[model samples]
Target: MSSTNRASSDDEFIVVREILSRLGDKWSVRVIHEAAGEPIRFTDLKRKIERSTPISSRVLTRTLKQLERDGLVTRRVYPVVPPRVEYRLTELGQQFLHHAQEIMGWTMEHQTAFETARREFEAQTTEQ
Candidate 1:
């Protein structure tokens, strides 16, 4: 292949990897899922996510910021006495969530097969 072609391929690979790395994060996925229907307050989101996975306030804040930077989530602050902040998914985020859900469904459907493959692989490795 030409050097230019190789360089293009490498750049594409890097971009895809970066995107996957961000979206594949557990906290990111959970946050996206939680922010699906309506805008959610920070504390409420934290509480809901913590019910399944424990996350610190700092980590959650960082994740939200990253998501916002990536244009996947939006943060809105209400001008009230106590101040209010809410997070919601953007259109792009919704599209991503739809694809992620499909991938999740596929994984669930093949979970048993995955487990069996892992067990076989482990057995073979241990035998050697």
Candidate 2:
């Protein structure tokens, strides 16, 4: 397996890694962003998040459920002829999003430098 697939052995930031993993998760961030402002139904969320359609419904469902369990998202179900389920970010979730978005801003700001370094490093490796 590639290094990316290997489990991290460094314990220095294991907790940080675990926490960061959730935000970096393929669906979690998108789902959170999509459900940020107001309560949204599953189908609407699925459509609002770009490229999320490729993520299996099962995976998305599980992600939403886990987020709910973590108190990051509130799930509401309406008792109607056809049950309506919606999700919205909890207060805790909003706080988390604030920080996460801040970090994302930092990354975006540095993305060009990061990409430049990556390209330089790759060129050196390929030449060697």
Best by TM-score: 1
lDDT of 1 at 5: 100
- Model 1's TM-score against the true structure: 0.88
Query: Model 2, 1-128: lDDT tens per residue?
Result: 55654555455368567667878887777788778997899888877774535666788799998788778899999999789999999998888788888989999999999999999999999999
Give candidates' CA RMSD values in order. 1.7, 6.7
Q: Model 2, stretches more than 4 Å misplaced?
A: 1-16, 50-53
The worst-scoring run of ten residues by lDDT in candidate 2 lies at 3-12
Clashing pairs in 1: none
The per-prediction tally of clashing pairs is 0, 0
Error of 2 at 53 (Å): 4.9
Q: Residue 23 in model 1: shift from native, Å?
A: 4.0
- Global lDDT of each candidate: 0.91, 0.83
lDDT for predicted candidate 2 compared with the true structure: 0.83
TM-score: model 2 vs. ground truth: 0.76
* TM-scores for the candidates: 0.88, 0.76
